[model samples]
Target: MIGRGSRRFGLGVLVGVLLGFAFALVGASPAAAHATLASTDPPQNQVLASAPDQITLTFTEAVRPVPARIKVIGPDRSVVNGGSPTSNGTKLVIPLGRDAGKGTYLVTFRVISADSHPIGGSFVFHVGAPSIDPPQEGEAAVTKADPAVVWALGAVRYLGYVGLVLLIGPMLFLARLWPARLSRRVPAKLVATGLGLLAFSTVAEMYLQGPYTAGTGLFGADADAIMNALGGSYGTTHTVRLGVLAAIAVLLRPFVRPQGPSTIDLAVVSFFAVVGLGTWPLSGHAGVSPAPAVSLVADAAHLASMGVWLGGLVVLVAVLLPKANARELGAILPVWSNWAMMSVIVLSLTGVAQAIIEVASFGPLFDTRYGRLVLAKVALLALVLVVAYFSRRLVLAPARKALVGAGGPADDDEELDEPPVKPLRRSILAELAITGVVLAVAAALVQTPPARSAADAPPEPYSVTLSTDLYRVRMELDPARTGGNSMHLYAYNPNGEPQTVVEWTVTATPADGSIDALDIPLLPVTADHAVAEPTFPTAGDWDIKITLRLSDIDQATVTQRVRIGD
Candidate 1:
């Protein structure tokens, strides 16, 4: 017959699988978490009468360009960039050759965001008209990281978290609550295994960083990409973590023995633990957060508390519960309970602070993918806490009575009754099972872009096609707000071929009539294309009248109502 504990464990596993499936569904589609291209001069797919003096790119956030990966291919399939590109905060400028003749120009670029993630993409613009076949590069414009590498990186990170739990839990138990009668070999081996895993994960992460950033396969990172990866903050932190692990290994040899860690050894280990933990946040989103100091400290504390709580449970369930007697349990359970409570409090507080900083507002908490994952984490955490409450009650009530009545009363009849140990073990197992899913959610959260950045992203430009008796006019207004807006106008015949426009004129009049009609000047770039910069004085609906003269005698005017916002 299946036991109740077995059924509960099965149910927990089922719930975890369901939650993981839900998260996978939400996060399956890949999206860029690094800086996104906001606007480009001589915008993509635009056709100019002549090549511009320079090509400028603006990103949502500041980025460092990979000089070797930034290239401009001219119509003649020759590199046309005049010199090295210049970066000024969020803008990158590439000077063009003076004598450049272009049909279509391809600009491919790769840049590193401030948070150490990489972003790459390509865009095309024409001089007179688009090429029959636009210039294409081999792999310079590959913006998506290899799927295998991405999955491998995520798996390595998960293993690293598991290693942290294993190392921390056994080390703490051996130092404080370990029974004198039980052999230390098993727990010692666990510590060693955890340490080895951490070392391996650190090295694997370093090697994978190059390919992850370069959007290449596992073995595709070039020497230059690898060198650049090492020079960045991500590589530096991983290197530091490896060093700390080495030092901890040396310091831990004596600590795991029967003699236990001395006061000085404990202090040094604690300091190194803190430094090692700090590296995690310093190399991730927290390092580049709006409030870096608070985020760094909170993220570190959150990780530490998680390690303590989860690791302690592992030790209690694996070694202590099975080996220790009733008397040993009575003495150990209360202390572990206190420690677990404290860790839970710390975890909850730091998690809330991180959510506030990363999500910023309630809208994003439900709207963004990052926010949805945060919600999933919270739900799983709540489930763990509920299970923990039952576990705590079972431990404190019976264990405290057992400790108080030790050696005073011989209650053979009461001892024959059900022991709390079995139920407590079941509860702990459920908590661990659920928390495993929580950890997976946390790992996915690290890969996702924060909700605040997604919320702050600018909306797409407004575009409309207006038709008249003679020609169809397509107008695009970038950032159609109560400010300066870049307007591009293209004229086409009824059959959709480019229509030659002899002259073009534009005017804007607000529906509210709060201001007089404003004349907008248009710079004709080609026979069928014109560009203009118009400033809206206030926020309201405005009617833009476009006059296009197809021939000297044949002319038509079209008016389109555009809503402009502040």
Candidate 2:
């Protein structure tokens, strides 16, 4: 027959799952955490009277200046940028010569974000007229990062997280709750392994940063490039973390013993541990967060709590539980349970704080990728907690009862009935598995753009090529907004050749007759195309009239209706 504890555990799981679903249903969308280009002086696809002497790009956050990462190719497939690029404040400036002829100039840029992620994009602008063919020779510069680099970087991050799990939790277990009889050798090796992984990941990240930002192959990042990367915020934090790890390696020996370190030694190591934890947030999204100080502290707390809880589980399953006698486990489990409870509380609180700061509002929690990952983490954590509750209630509680009733008939009978050790081992192993997935999601979360920052990010591109019998006229409304919108028109003959537009005119009127027709100024881009910037005052269905004269003798007008939203 099932015990009272078993029934309670099952009920708790059911309730937690229901609550998780309810929360997901009511939650707003999830958001991806990524830095974006806020604006550009010569906006994408803009037409200019003459080539500007420089191109300036403004991002939502500060970024590292990697000269080789920014390339400007003119209509002739020749580099037009005159000097080294400059990164100042939130702007990246690329100088160009005034002689950058009348045609399209494609600017491709790659920069390391404030959070140490590599972001790259390309934009094109026309001077005097559109080029017959824009430079496409070095198209490699505009593509995504090398797949090997992507995999290697992700693997390194995963390794570092695993190392953190091994390093932090086992140390605490040894210092406080470990059984005296258990050998310290295994636990000590685990700590050393964790430290090694973290140190190796940090060094690898520095080397990878150069190739990542430059959009090059893995081996492409050299010593000079890596050194230049170190000069940036991401590199500095990594270097500091390496130093902390070195100190930790030296001081952690005493603490790995069953008797543990002296109070002074413990104090010193703790201080460095906290400092090292700070480096993670300082080099990541938290450092540039809206409330940087608060977010950084919360992130550090979150990391520390995760290490204690998840890492503790690892030690309990792999070493402590297996080696300890029932009496030792009865003693160790309760203390470990209390520690886990405390870690959970800290994790929950700090997680909520970081989420609030990063998510900004309820809407993004359901709407964005970051939010979805967060929800997954929350759901999995809830499941882990449910299992933990059962483990404590059925396994630890019964074991404690047996310990109290030792040498009595009731103790022997109860121990035989439950066999709590096997169940407890299984529960802890399950919890570790779930938390491992949670850590993976956490890694992804750090890479994403915060919901708050992405909430007001630029809209998706809106452009569609249209065709007609008299002449194929392509009308594009940039950003598809209600207010000011940039529009471009390209005309072609029935034979699919560029057709000269002698005269072009456009009129926009509300389809519902709420507003009168307004003229839009059309500027000639080439023999076959013209551009215009029009303002739609309100949100509604609007009709656009495009009249183009392919020749003095032949002209055609086409009307297209489109809906605009606020």
Candidate 3:
């Protein structure tokens, strides 16, 4: 009867989750990806008539500027920014020095997105004419956090997850299922240890955020960065989490005692648990998602369900099975099985909801890092469920058969023969081991950009300067992918002055000779400037040959190779 009911419940849960996912898909719209450059004043690679007083950058989302990281470098390789960059929602305005020169200028910026991820990139614009050699910052164009800090943050997140499982499981079992004759010492110690680990991990994460966002080493966070971290939404949620933990600690004092918790104490602790779980989502991708309310509730429920189910398994394998006698096991196993089943149902439902909101489409699910991790997590969870099923069968089948043989149902005082313990323990242990790996994957998922954002992210612009005996040609390609690309060409004399051109001819051919050379038509805007829209049919290396005619007698051709990506 128990097995049949569990199957029915599982089926209903699966149907409900599928229905919810379908509805989410129907209502879903394209959400803004990570913070990306949407547009810029004095547009990249363009030759402006004059230098503007300021440059404005529009991003896909609101961002907080990183100090000392946003600057404009003039043609003379000197800082030309007049003042600090100011942000108005998604737009950032950088004041340019009044004396900015008449050559290439590089604008580099680094900022933190609303979701706590750092984004950095650079672009170039020309004043009057292109520079003979543009100012370069090398790898500093795209700022990156230190490897040690990244690894440490991931480890701390995983530690927090482990603590949740350990703490939630034992405390729950002690309150409801623990036998009166058994000592509470071991379970109480487990609860204390879990609490300590959680507290430590939370404090560590708060400190790590400063360095992580600053693109610095683990110990490189300065006073300003630390203070900024504390002032942001990430810091606010974590601070609330610490407060919630403190309240839980005080309320739990009576809960883990031998006498168990009073009804009022249980209600208060439950309230704190919901608030605590909420902090995890409010500080992550969910807080900035398209459906923030739905994402928050789903994420919180997912955490709670994971904590209860995995934590319960730990308590069952380590403490209950080893110590409880036949009659005690008969009474405890059935109730625990029911709770585990319910927790799994909630976990599955919330996991599906989050995937729908974050991944959005099938293409991203199969193409992006975030989506692939989700697949790996699902595979691991399925394996754990298989082991859980076997474990449940072992417990229920024996307990039911023994009850039938003993007449109808055994009373609380009646003794029943113990079921096989060794096999059950092995199955539970296997479940816990797989769950640990799943937790690690979850920690990684939190750090990765969502599939929707990764898939929608724009490709980097490609630019190159080629030289011939007669002249230098700089070609700029916007989003060099397998599609129509806007191309701009600027001609300069060997002495770094604008060179007049009478005619321009351009053609592109695949490096492997897969296709014949295709002529690209160019329209001249000035004697030294021309623009065209060229289409690359496929993704691979292509050779572009440009023939310029200074006069009938002074023509030169330059060939440059460019790579196009899918």
Candidate 4:
């Protein structure tokens, strides 16, 4: 018999192992996928020609222009630019002030893009004279990944998926094995446990997903603030997940009741329940599963399988393992094991498939924050599986040895061979505990970018090429950032120099072809770039009309319509 001291030492060892496991997760927790300014417009490590007209810094994603400021450092490291940087969208620009003296200028800025992401970056450029013509600029919006949040929150997302699956996966497996009208209705305790886990993870996820998307806080009250942020891809997906979750909440009533379930009924219930739960990856980093559609489907399958496997173990220990009768367990363990093993295999394969899709290249795997966190997660998974393998091999097979003397039907060979396993039950419980930790880690991984980065979506590059006449004009929109009002115009006279014009008139009219020719002030943004800064006061479709007078008699006008969403 195990003595008290022996038990204490063993318990200490178990606690130490769990603590160590948690520490490993913590060590990896700080690592993140958040992309910061890798480099900037004027660039870091390089001497500049006389000062450039405007400044721009590049980051991992689309950035907004709110805290965007250019800190023009003096020889004493004092700021020069008037205040903050002016953001147009993809680039941040500062108007050159009076007689800008000679010296290196440090332009620092912070911005919140339309995506609700916050980014801070800086660059250095020199100005020779006061300045040349103003440069048309866009907002510096880079949608960087928050690695820490991704890792931490991802665990919640995936854990929620696991809870739903485990919460329901077994009933389906049992239905497949046992005939309809016979599978025991899931117990209230089991349903409560699953729902409890789901709720906990969801609360954690809400906190994580909100700020993580916008690069906000990890533990602050910002989660509530991020409600509107759900309008995006990640938000949209989680929204649907909520709907599926609601269904589960309602269905729990029927599921928890004590009644036998039919195979068809169980399958239908399990599939939809999981569908309501597992579809999260679809709108998240894993949605663009590397295997494409098949990979995506497989990911869902894998999630469902994991839910069944892990959640089932929880059920077994809580509901079946504690029972004094070995007979009931003997009859069910093997069948459950078979299904559990199958689910494990499926989950592993699908996870790999999704990983392949997310980590497009080897560089992102190590060089990117997302990649490193993913690798850490993979390590944790390997550890959990190691524990699982031990339970399956050493603890389980021998526990069945006790069944040798038990009297049972010969036809029950499978169940008959397995006496009520008791000692091995501890191993099952251990495995389930470790599995919970794994799910926590997985939750964080889900919130992270599948691939080290989303460069895979590679925005569709497009530009408007215009061939206007005598003084040929070509307007090309920069591909670095898309949407919003963006275009570059190059005009050359027959001699190919600056087109000295007697009159330059540009205007905007309603797209309705309204003869009113919308009366609006034409703001001169750049020598070559001009804009109609009309108060878009309201959100709607608006038209921009450009009228250029080369000499007064030689004027050309082009009208373009733009659509804005609220």
User: What range of 10 consecutive residues in model 1 has the weakest lDDT sum?
Assistant: 402-411
Query: lDDT per residue, candidate 1, 1-566, as tens digits?
Result: 12356436544654564465455434443223337788899887687889888999999778877766788888778788788888899999988876457566888888877777777777778887655444776634545778898888888888888888988888888888887777888888888888998999889888987887777789989988877766668888999999999998999876667878788888999999999999899888898887789999999999999988999999878887777766677677767766776687678767876877777666677888999999999899988988886776664455535233222233355543345666777888999999999988987787777887775656556777788878888787877988899998878888666789999999999998888889999999878889999999898899999999988799999999999976
The superposed Cα distance between candidate 3 and the true structure at residue 134, in angstroms, equals 1.3
Query: Candidate 4 lDDT, tens digit per residue, 127-225?
Result: 431112212112223234456765666567665766675566544434343323233454455665666677777667655655565544465325343
Best by TM-score: 3
Give model 1's clash tally: 0
Considering only N, C-alpha and C atoms within 3 Å, which residue pairs clash in candidate 1? none
* Local distance difference test, each candidate: 0.79, 0.77, 0.83, 0.51
Which has the higher lDDT value, candidate number 1 or candidate number 4? 1
- Model 2 compared with the native: what TM-score? 0.81
Q: Write the per-residue lDDT of candidate 2 for residues 33-130, one digit (tens) a residue.
A: 34678889898877788888899999877787677778889877778789999989789999996466777788888877777767777777888655
Least accurate 10 contiguous residues by lDDT in model 4: 129-138
lDDT of 1 at 545: 92
Clashing pairs in 3: none
TM-scores of all candidate predictions against the true structure: 0.76, 0.81, 0.92, 0.54
- Which should have the higher TM-score, number 2 or number 3? 3
Expressed as tens digits, the lDDT of each residue in 1-566 for candidate 3 is: 14777777786777777677667756766566867778889787877888889999898888888766787888888888899888888998999876567998899888878887777778898888888778886523446778898889899999999988878888888778888877788888888778787888889998998888887788988978877666668888888888987887777778656788888887888888888889899888898888899999999999988988999888877777677665666688788878888899989988998898898876677889998998899889888988888877676666533332222233556554644667778888999999999999999998888888888887778888889999999888888999899998889999878899999999999999998999999999899999999999999999999999999799999999999988
